[model samples]
Each structure stands twice: as structure tokens, then as C-alpha cells.
Target: MPPSLLLQHAPCARPTAKRTASLFSAAVLASKDGGGARPPRPRPRGKPRFSRQSAIRKSFQQEQVVFSTPVSPDPTVAVIGGGASGLACASALAARGVRSVVFDTGMHGLGGRMATRAVDDERQLVFDHAAQFFTASDERFQKLVEEWVERGLVREWRGSIGELEAGGHFRPIHSSTPRYIGVNGMRPLADAMLPENDLIKVIRPSWISKLEPFNGLWRLFENEKPRGQYDAIVIAHNGKCANRLLSTSGLPQLTKQMKRLELSSVWALLAAFEGPFPIPHNNSYGTFEGAFVRGVDSLSWMANNTRKLFPFETDRPECWTFFSTASYGRRNKVPQENIPNATAEKVQREMLGGVELALGLSKGSLQLPFYTRVQLWGAALPMNTPGVPCIFDPQGRAGICGDWLTGSSIEAAVLSGISLGDHVADYFASCGERPEEFAIGLDDSLNRVEGHDIGQFPGLDSSQKPQVAEAQLTATI
Candidate 1:
């Protein structure tokens, strides 16, 4: 968002034309028609007449009065979505000395998709039923992760293995260098990036319905109510929300492109057990009766409610969350009513011989706890189509940045944000002054920079002298 200049005073006020003409005429003359000349009429009483000198002085003073121009205030950025991407953008803006605010529709304290749910009536246990985990592939991101680790905001999952079910083709488990998780859940990472109460403001249970650019400022509306205005806006949520807002602004071409994109939905189940889960704590994956599903190792994913950081504990044995693929979601006709938890439970029961067996216990082993919930992820993953730009730079003023812009991963989102942010910075620097409200196509700029490959720093490239395996390990990790 670009900064705005504020003008405290209105432009110089002008005098009425009648007043100006009267001052200029000074004296009124009477005309005699077809007869002898007539004498001048008396001027109106109580009205002061202006001398020629006074009139000239008044006009000169008016000409000399200068109207001050409004100077824009420092750019105040508004970020929509309290997810990782939104928080990251806010943090980046803050680091640049730009103030920002984040708005989310989720529960006041909860973060999007890194959501947690309670299972029992007593509200004893909770589980993270949204994003399982995230990975970082950039050095800058890694440094941020290190800080998170130091502050105990996150912890490494330690063990992550991918197995191909066919022919028992299992590759040796390659531990991710540092797969991070929130101390309480994945929400902490988002929370950490946001500013404290005084610095950054987070508005929850609020959703932006429209964004209108007016008089060099963006006005955000919530259900048609005027929220406020900002110098710039960052739409960090899914494409659907962004598209909806952009569509209302009468941008037909942008609306058409946004509508072309598709999204998928998922059904997740959160269950509590009376004893240790039957599956290994590390996690497992396979197709059960044609249903492509994943049974997460709650332990590896840090799904323990007993931890002090988590909301609930008590004597509950364990809590586990299961997820079904988008394909399965389509086939089962999962109704909107039975979102997330319910859908998760139904799928689990169908594949694993009823909910009781899925929890690795008898029907009467424990209370059913919480009802199932379903989460519909519109634009969950972007389908990579041929000829699609890695980043769509339609209007230089606005650019698309998200996991969908690059690839599906936390790293992709971060990389896309950084790239787009850099592009915007460069564009603004080149402009030298505030840009007019219009879309400037960057087709040529993108073409010129295309095909550039990222290179590793010196001493980091493989072509250099080989080092001891341990030394390499320390450096690489």
C-alpha cells in the first residue's frame, strides 16, 4: 500500500460572481430611451459601494491566496485473512515501518484452518482438525522458524515418512530437517507473526464483503457497512473471497479470470479414545475400500491434549483426527450440514468398521464426545494448468500471490509473497511518485525476467570442495 498525503484545509474559497461584478462596476448608469438624457439613479440604501482601488485590491488578494495540497499519510495496510499468508504479509509490512491490520471471520481467538475443536461435553480434550503440518524451504523462512523454536512457539515433528502403498514400495524415511508445529497447534505461528495489542490490531468475527477504491484510498465494507479506509489492501484468504470482493468493484475481466479457478472440499473427523491408538504414532496412509484416506499419527503430529499448551487434558486416553481426500468427498456427496467432524466420523465408520473400531475400542468404551464438523475449502489447491503464469501480474498495482500462484505448500506461499512484494517495491521505486488508479500490464517486464534461475551462495554450491559428511550435514540442515 502506498502512503497518503493529508490536506487539513480546503482550497481557497471563491467570491460570488454578482459580488465581483458589483465591485468592478462601482457606479450604476441609467439609460434614456427615445427622449432627453436621464439623471443617474440613487444606489440601494444600506449597501456599501466598492471603490475601484478596493475592488482591485480585493481581486489581487484573492489571486495571491494559495490553496495547500493534501499530503498523503504514511500507508496503512489492511490484510484480509489471519492465516499464515496474511500474518506473514502483515509482518513484512511492519518490518518496513508500515502499519497494518488483519481481519478474520473465524472465532475471535482462533486462527483459520489451523483450527482446533473440543471433543467432550465436559470440554476436556481438543484436537487440531485442519492443516496437519507445514514445511519451510527458504533460508529466510528457516531463520524465522529458528526464532519460533527459540521462543517455544513451535517444535519440530522430528519424524515424517512417505510410503507408496503399491508392492510395499517403501523408501527409507527421510526426516525433514525441521518440520515445525505450533506449541499449542499450528495457530501459534500465525499468532507469533502478528503484532501485540497496541501495535497491530486483529479484528475477528469480521468478514470483508467488498473493497472499493475511492479518492486514493481503499474502503473495506463488512456486509455493506463502512468499516474504514486504508492506503493499501492485501487479500490473503482463498481465491473465492478475493474474487468476490474484486468482482463487486465492476472489474469484469478480473472477475472472469477469478471465476475460472476451482476449489475442493474436505471432511475431517476428530475422535477421542480410551486407550492408546492402534496405529503407530508416526502415522499411516492407504486406500481403505476405495476410499483414499490418511490416518495421522497423532503423536508425531503432536495431537496430545494433555500438554499444558493445549486447551484440554484430563484422563482421556488420546485424541486423533482423520482426513478424507477431495475425491472421496465428491463421491460421498458429503452434505454441507455434516461438515468436518461429522463427515470425518462417517467416513471413518464406513472404512474402519464403524466409529467404535476406528477409535480402536468398543462402542461403549467412551462417550461419542463431539459431533462431526465439515470444512469446505474453496480453492484448497490450485490445479496447475499448462501455460499458466507462476504469478499473474495483470495490473502492476495488484498482483496475485499465494500457494496457488507457485505450488501447494507453505514454502510456496512464502516464496510467492516475497516475489510479489519485491516486484511491487521495484515498481513503486521506478514510478517515483504515487501511481494513478489504473491497471498497468507487466507482460514485458515478466518476459524480460523469465528463465532466470536461483543460484546458491558461495561455499554452498556442490561444485566446491567436498566437506566431511557431518560438516555438510550441519551446514545443510
Candidate 2:
């Protein structure tokens, strides 16, 4: 079947193969008994067994060579931000026989928003503080996710999640769409996706403060110290850091495009309580692990971290993470690196009050948490997007890829990174000449999906909505 025409079939077809084998063995045994038994039932038809042939796989299969030889030999790339997009870009480039170095500011590990906090207290508390979970809608990303599942690095998060209305009404989100998370935590998944080869080098706990173009190469610097130069550079992060780095990078067009992205600040509150919330729910959908709070100013989301990790383990202390609304975050914004004690206490009080309202509990009904923490995401997520897969500057040999470029999701960041890697590989295959299709995302005529928030937004009634039409994202790179 044509790649695009292939339909997604149910995963239950594997049992049919086992059934057919049993029937064939039974027929042999009956034949040995003087053919007294009836012939075996005919093999079933019309269903394809589980297959690994995704659209992305088929596209590569059609090509003469999966990894074409690059015209420029041994070209090195510098990828800033070791998040999903940055790691994915490095992986893609490595597959094409190119080398890359990834730079990140993560003190503990990589996986920017796919973060986790492990408390050293005796309670053995762990929390997926940032992105709760991710869904794969694109074929390319689906293929990668499937591979990760087989390798035991990722698993489906089947926990019950839905909307928590203002008056404490719990409505489960009714969708079969699979939600995925790392086996240990979101950060490990990002760590696993890093290419296991010498071609990809990672420098963690390092920040690239500036980029200087000198003699046809981009030189990266960390404050006063110089981090080696590279033939090409890919900016795989957004927000203030990216803007400041690009402002003096000598790439006016790319800088202009980067400045167009607007990000929203968000506050995340993590607390460990002695027991679960006393909210009532139907037993059919399972215990609520997460919820998107609606009509609540101080809170926008809440999830049970302990339940998400061990859904059946009821004896453990319940750890819940809450997120403040964009507007609330803006109003109560504080310095991220060093938040004041008074501000933290106020935010905790107000957000917990909001949580009480979401659960319809009386004031001060909930018990004090055993452990509590507050973090402010200055550039939590993008408010809007450019609706492009990625942005690249051929003349400056620079590119930008992130969830902010396409949509607010881990899948978007992966897709954008892979696309830019392929685009650059194609450019090098042509011997330093820009290909006819310089960048597919730069084409304005193509019908592309607009950027949509994967999580709760400022004004959306529904927890999440489908990606808007092409008209919604009219901004061009």
C-alpha cells in the first residue's frame, strides 16, 4: 500500500497469528488419527498483522541509499540546548554520518521541560515537575516512540485524566489516544534518545552565552571562554536565553524570526500529602491521576505523581503537582534563580487555595503537606507559534528548532529537530550549494497545521484542543 494511504489498524491482530498456528497443529494431529476430524478452519483475512513499516520507514526504503554520503566530509555542528529538539537533531545528524556537539544548561541532566525532581528525604519522593506526558500524532514521531517502547525506555501512561470544573465536577477525558512517559522519568527518555556514537558529543552543565561569526564559521562562547567553532549551528531552545544569544549573532533575519515567538510564564507547585484527595468519582474510569482545572485563576492543572508512577500502590504518600494559570503566573512572577521567601509562601497559599476551590473543599480543609516546593517557569510554553517545521538561515548556516516553532508538545520538538537535520544533510549532499527545496517549512504555499497548546491555556474551556486551521498561524519565518 502507498505510504500515505496506509491505515492504522488495531493492535489486536497478533492473537490471530497464534490462533492460526494452533489450528494448523490441530489439523496435523487429526490427520494422524485416520483423518476423522474436520479440516482446520481457513486462515482469517483482511487484517494486516502488526507491522513496523511506518510512513517514515517507507520514505527511507524508497530511497536508493538511506544515508547518502555528504559532499563536505567531516563537517561538525554545534547544537545549543540539550533538550528534546537538540538531542533529536544531533541524533538525526549522526545517522547521516555528521558529527555534532550538544550544549545544555541543565545542572542535573538534560530534558528541559521533561524534568523530574527527586527529593532526598526519607519519603523517597519523586515528581515529574514539568511536562506531565506526551502524545505522538505524527507518523515519524510515532515510529520513534514505538522503538522507545520496545527498548523499555518509554511506556504508556494509562492513568485516568480529565477536567476538574470550577464546582468540583470531575469529567474524565474520553479518548483512546495513547499518552507516553519515560519508565523512570521524562529525563531518562531524553538521555536514552541521545545517539550512542562518537559522532555525537554532549557537554552538560554548560551554557553557550554568545555566538560569533568569524571567517565563514560560527564560534560559540561561554561568557569570556570560547567554546570551539563549528561549520553550522542549530538553536534548539527558545525564550530569553535564545533571544539574547541571537541578538548579537550577526544574523538579522534569523534574529527577527526568533523575536516573534512569545512565551508564557508558569508556576508549578509540588506538595506531598499524607493521603489522596477526598474527591468522589466513578469507579469505572479508575482513580484520577491528573486533571486540568477550569475557571480557577491560581491553578490550572493538578496531578498525582506517586499515583502516576505506581497507580496501584495506595500505601505510599500521595504527591500532587499543581500548575498556576498563565495569567496567575504573570501576576505572581518572581526571579526564577532566587525567589524570595515571602513570594514563595504567598504563591503557595494562593495556589493551594485555588486547589481547594477546584476540589470544592472548605477553607483550610486539606492538611498541611509534608514537603512543598515552588518553581517558576519564566518561558514555560509559547503563547503562539510560527506554524513552520523549523527556521534556517543558509547564508549564516544557522537554524532554530523547538516546540515553540511548531506547537507546544514534545512531539513537535522532535519533529522539528529531525526535519532541520534532514534539511541540513540535504544541503551538504549538494556540495555547499542550497538545494532546490532550501527549507520545506519556509514554503508559504504548503497547507500546514497551525500551532496549538498541548496543555491548558489561558482562555480555552477544553483542557486541550485540536491544532487550528492553517489560517490560525499566518506568521512566516
What is the C-alpha local distance difference test score of each model? 0.43, 0.68
Alpha-carbon shift of residue 228 in model 2 (angstroms): 0.3
Off by over 4 Å in 1: 1-73, 108-110, 118-123, 159-172, 196-199, 251-257, 279-316, 333-348, 351-378, 385-396, 418-477
Q: Which candidate is the best by lDDT?
A: 2
- Native-referenced Cα lDDT, model 1: 0.43
Total backbone collisions for each predicted model: 17, 0
lDDT of 2 by residue, 65-139 (tens): 112222234356789988888888887876665567789999999988888888988887888888887777778
Local distance difference test, candidate 2: 0.68
**Cα TM-score of candidate 2:** 0.78
TM-score of each: 0.61, 0.78
